[model samples]
Target: MRLDGTVALVTGASSGIGAAASVSLARQGAAVAVVARRRERLDELAARIRGDGGDVLVIEADITQEAQAVEAVERTASELGRIDTLVNNAGVMLLGPAAGAPMTEWQRMVEINVLGLLYCAHAALPYLLKAAGAGPRHVADMVNVSSVAGRVPRSGSSVYNLTKHGVGAFSEALRQEVGQKHVRISLVEPGAVETELAGHNRPEVLETIRARFGGIERMQPEDIADAITYIVTRPRHVAVNELLIRPTEQE
Candidate 1:
């Protein structure tokens, strides 16, 4: 379960789950590249990791942009030498009834949640394969942060659900294609974690959803981070493919 000398790149790393995961990976001795659109937040996260004597790089870029995504991976590899793990954690959730939902929000969701992950994966695949073959760990890994909405489409979250479902499907196909190469791909599906994901919802919808979760405790970002750490820290021969985490009282 040791990740010493490994280098991991985590997108959406400004705060919440991505931030927590970045710190967790650093704590495990992996040099981490923290990426997000918020340069300030990324800088702060990098500073924190460095304060703890961990190796980190702050890369501020909008991953939805293909060029930026490619550059991010390139920069990480250039500074760190290789990428042993990649966490596609950048995503947007625009939840609402599909019939009358704003088209712009849907477009944004698709672009960030689906296409953004694709761009990062495409750009990082070659490096991942190289690291898998030559790095100390000898096994590279990819973790896609999906949602339980991907598995069960709720009534009011058509677009958000679609994007997550797409992530699951993509992750599955990629896992099959890359398994023989010893590059492990895994999906982490979280149910109702307390994060900024719901911040993108309309005011009315956000109020309603908050009221609903107010009664039942939601999972924290650290919980999901812990799950991610567990998956990536496993032995070279062990691949934990899919992990579904929800608060005990979520249902």
Candidate 2:
């Protein structure tokens, strides 16, 4: 599982799951490039990783933009050598009713959760493939972070559901396409992690969410990071195709 000499690029790395995953991968000996829009947060994360003797690069770019996404990937490969792993973790969840819901919220979700992930994956695929062929590990990993809502639909989260479902579908198809080349593509669906995702919702929606599962313990970002690390560190012949992670009491 040691990833010494490998290079990885993680999106949405300003905080939460992306941040934790970047640290985890670095700890496992991968030089990591952390991508997000918040430059200050990214600088803070880079400092922390560097303090621990890990190599990191901070790229402050809005991945929703295709050109920025492509540049992010190209710069990472140029600066850190080939990208052996890509974590498509940039996403937003604006949960609300479909009827009378702010169209902007839906649009934002599609832009970040769907288009952002796609752009990063598309740009990184060639580098990942090249890495799979040359590395001592003989494999590359692309881990897409979705949500449990990707698997199950709820009334207030219709569009959120749509985006996550699309992630799952795309991951499966891409996995099939690249499996023979040893570029392992995986989907990670999480439930009720304590992150800033819920803060993006409306006050009314937050109240309803609190009324339902607020008492239940939510998983930490590091918990999901652990799942991601496990997926990428597997042996060359192994592929952890999909993992649905939830707190013990999330049901």
Each prediction's whole-model lDDT (CA) = 0.93, 0.95
The count of residue-pair clashes in candidate 2 stands at 0
Score every model by TM-score.
0.98, 0.99
* Global fold similarity of model 1 (TM-score): 0.98
Among residues 3 or more apart in sequence or in different chains, the pairs in candidate 2 whose N, CA or C atoms overlap within 3 Å are: none
Residue 246, candidate 2: Cα error in Å is: 0.8
**lDDT per residue as tens, model 1, 85-154:** 9999999877767787889999999999999999999999999999889969889999999999889988
Best by TM-score: 2
For residues 1-251, write the lDDT of model 2, one tens digit per residue.
79999999999999999999999999999999999999999999999999999999999999999999999999999999889999999999888778899999999999999999999999999999999999769999999999999999988889999999999999999999999999999999999999887887899998888877799999999999999999999999999999999889987
Model 1 is weakest, by summed lDDT over 10 consecutive residues, at: 92-101
